[model samples]
Target: MRFSEEVCERLDNYVYRLIDPRNGETFYVGKGRNNRVFDHAAGVLDVADDDNQTLGSKLDRIRAIKSAGLEVLHIIHRHEIPDAAVFEVEAALIDAYPGLTNLQGGHASSDRGPMNHLELIDKYSLPQFPSNPEHRLVLININKLEDRFDRRAIYNLVRYCWRISKSRAEKAEYVLAVVRGVVVGAFKPENWMSATRENFPDIPYANGSELHRIGFTGIEAPGDIWNLYVGLRGKRVSDPRLKHSQNPVRFWNC
Candidate 1:
């Protein structure tokens, strides 16, 4: 199902989607050159389940479609895009499709992902995070949080489920939940533990992924501590180094 050399050359860089023919739902979004659009269906059997849980899930979906005697559908959303602008096109499509099985978020997604009108205002108006902070802290981007204003939701999303150094995580005194660039929530970790069902029974998504990740149980920061860092209006990290990139976790002054 690969493209011919001439077609591949003409297509250049493109953004594509993989669809489940059974349900007419898009299951994956990706960007690549050559015959990359057809590669997922062709190489579905070779992907190891244990190596990457997210990718494993995608392969599983492809296998299910095949078992039903249906071929997976590939759609090129955009083609012949210049290399410089391909990332932005891919990222915008990723944001549009929330249920995509893409292994990682789009490039530079954390700092510039989807935001509402009020969120946009806060992002531009908030005070910048301290460039040289004296306190030890772990800045976590909770971009996946569904309920941003819910206190418990923010606490749960910020504290639990991360692939961070246990020793370095212990050295940090506080964890701040950053959405886009703003610090929306703050907490103090009491204990750090493996991200397993035993440690995080409340999080169903934690099952079988403990080998490479860790989480924490913690209390909300004291009023003064929260005010200093999060403030009443919230603090924003404008420094390029401090902004959330591909990795959601950032350790500061530790």
Candidate 2:
């Protein structure tokens, strides 16, 4: 059901959740203006709008509920949110609900999303990254990193399979693996290579056709260099420009 014009005006930018009537689970979390919340169940999205696999899943779920002769439950978790603050609200909700059908994390969710007690302590205690780094640096968010303790896993996650410009990617000397705005590891790229099965025989490719992505093979940054950016204590990124927002990649001095 669509919101009335007056209700829409009062709501302004708001965060909402779509619940599965069959199980009362929130499947989607989103933020928008007007009757944007109702659009999903109204069948506004199609295969053409499948920006990611998750959107397609969301559509399928909505269809299933409708076919079962049930209506999807919509909840306005928070309303009249300021335009600037809505992203954080939406992201917080998305993090609170783990299995949401959102295509991407909330804006700046990688940088300032959920954290455990130890992570919270580390986030505040670590040294801040250089505000003006002299080295041509590429800040790659390893937010999706599954293995936090493995050095090899951190390196592999930071170095492989990214959709980026080859020429621009090669210009950077160092890549910083960031997790929740903290520089977890630093590396110096020795080579930039296409993300293909031939180039990376170790990685399992979904198909034979080479993908249009590039990754790097690198060694850990030298101790002196590492200490400057990331030490045993780790480095926290405080600069707004350095924060990993929607894009998993950001460049500095390049």
Candidate 3:
């Protein structure tokens, strides 16, 4: 939704709100120039592909709003402000609205505002990965066993069973990938709708298997102290007990 440079010049520097028509709720709030508001309104149909998931979910929400036969009401909260002040103002408005569909929130600032994504993650204690969680975390040993065939068994487990619980798989939060006693990546759950050729279509696989699902995402790695290392290490997902073990699916507790 690119606007001409001329239009963008005139529209620069503004914080906006999108009002839902069905129940008159404010589903989203954002700050931008060059028709960022309309971009959200227009992006409902372009759900994220295997390449990107962040933008697609926001678009999905907007599409749902439009599908309700209601249009979003765009309101300019403020305009003609200094570039630095925009972040301050945007963060304040976001803080005012307790629950907004705005996936990425306000930017960094010198004052109190919505915490940045990483801050929010730590603030809220996210990635509370538990190897023995009643939920799930599919720990993939970076290297396969010398005597094994492939990740078929681990795949079936992650795709089927819950981490700690004996019951079948259900809601799962994160999957921490470990390598030789070090945590390399943390993936968040995305959407895997089916088992078709397209099911979990976006994710890649070492075996070229279509079952390489895409419902999970790799997130930022934790601090060095939390990263797993050889010899006795920290607790939770960082435990080094699995350092020399061939087990692909290990456990971690928050």
Candidate 4:
């Protein structure tokens, strides 16, 4: 917590932590250069984006610590890290402390491969495939749930199913909602929260009877018509089956 100005200036790049002095618990993790730690502890608001409130949570947390009349405990965990490696180190720290208020898991250089929501929106909007044509995406094969492959049923499942891991659901950045070998819809999940009958009362079948009400995300459903590839026999799509295409896939690449 104590470093002379001369010592601080010598630090090129580092990963640091902000600990709540009262409890000795780490509440935030970040990576940056000299004096970066002080800027955060000083509560400096730079580059204020009108719409982005994610960083505000961290600032609020820091304020709460200061309100208790104890200075924030700052620790430089790693020093002299190059710009390229700092992000990865910061991400590792975040993963270690999962409940930290920091959002977006540090900028670790495209964590989920190249297929992200922004990139895919641009990909499909401009369908003249790029020179690197191997686009990867998380495909949700609704065909497996044959009886419930329609729009209405699939919607409820993704939103209400507690069985689905939070990471898996989010990784489906541009979900290719497939049914009977055709791509019927593309959905982007914004965020996930525990489902409740009281909140999502309109979910046609959830009559205060679901055994588990946990992972729900508002689906960004595609518009009326979509591009679906009907196979040679107009049967199910085999080439990109969940296993075949390595879909339901992690680390999706475009």
Question: What overall lDDT, based on C-alpha atoms, would model 2 receive against the true structure?
Answer: 0.83
In the predicted model 2, the residue pairs found to clash are none
The alpha-carbon lDDT assigned to residue 96 of candidate 3 equals 72
Q: Residue 30 CA error for candidate 3 (Å)?
A: 1.4
Q: Which ten residues in a row have the lowest lDDT in candidate 2?
A: 45-54
lDDT of 2 by residue, 1-254 (tens): 57899998998888899999999999999877888778875547644434645477788889999999998889899998997898889999999998788867787788778888988898998888899999999998875666565668888888887878889988998998989988888899999988877787776642455477788888989989888988886899999989888888999988
Candidate 2 regions off by >4 Å? 20-25, 43-73, 144-149, 196-198, 204-212
Clashing pairs in 3: 48-56, 130-252, 131-251, 131-252, 181-228, 190-215, 200-214
Candidate 3 worst ten-residue window by lDDT = 161-170
Backbone clash count, each prediction separately: 0, 0, 7, 1
Clash pairs, model 1 backbone: none
* Residue 168 displacement in candidate 2 (angstroms): 0.8
TM-scores for all candidates: the values are 0.91, 0.81, 0.40, 0.48
Q: In model 1, where do residues sit more than 4 Å from their true spots?
A: 44-54, 144-147, 204-208
Could you give the C-alpha RMSD of every candidate to the true structure, in order shown?
2.6, 3.6, 14.1, 12.3
Ranking by TM-score: 1, 2, 4, 3
Candidate models: Cα lDDT each: 0.84, 0.83, 0.48, 0.54
Q: For candidate 4, lDDT tens digit of each residue in 1-254?
A: 54677877678789999888888889888777757788777666555421234467778878888898878888899998887787778877776775787744444222222333644453244322122214345544332244323655665554554434556556554555543233444556676555656656676555554444344556644442123221111122333223212123222452
- Which lDDT tens digits does candidate 3 get at residues 1-254? 35688977887798888777777777667777776667666663323312244465556667787798766777888887689788778877876775677544444221134344644443234333334334344454433322122234323323421123322112444555443333335444453333333443433442333232333323332343224321122122333433324234554432
Model 4 spans > 4 angstroms off: 1-5, 48-52, 108-254
lDDT winner, 1 or 3: 1
lDDT of predicted model 3? 0.48
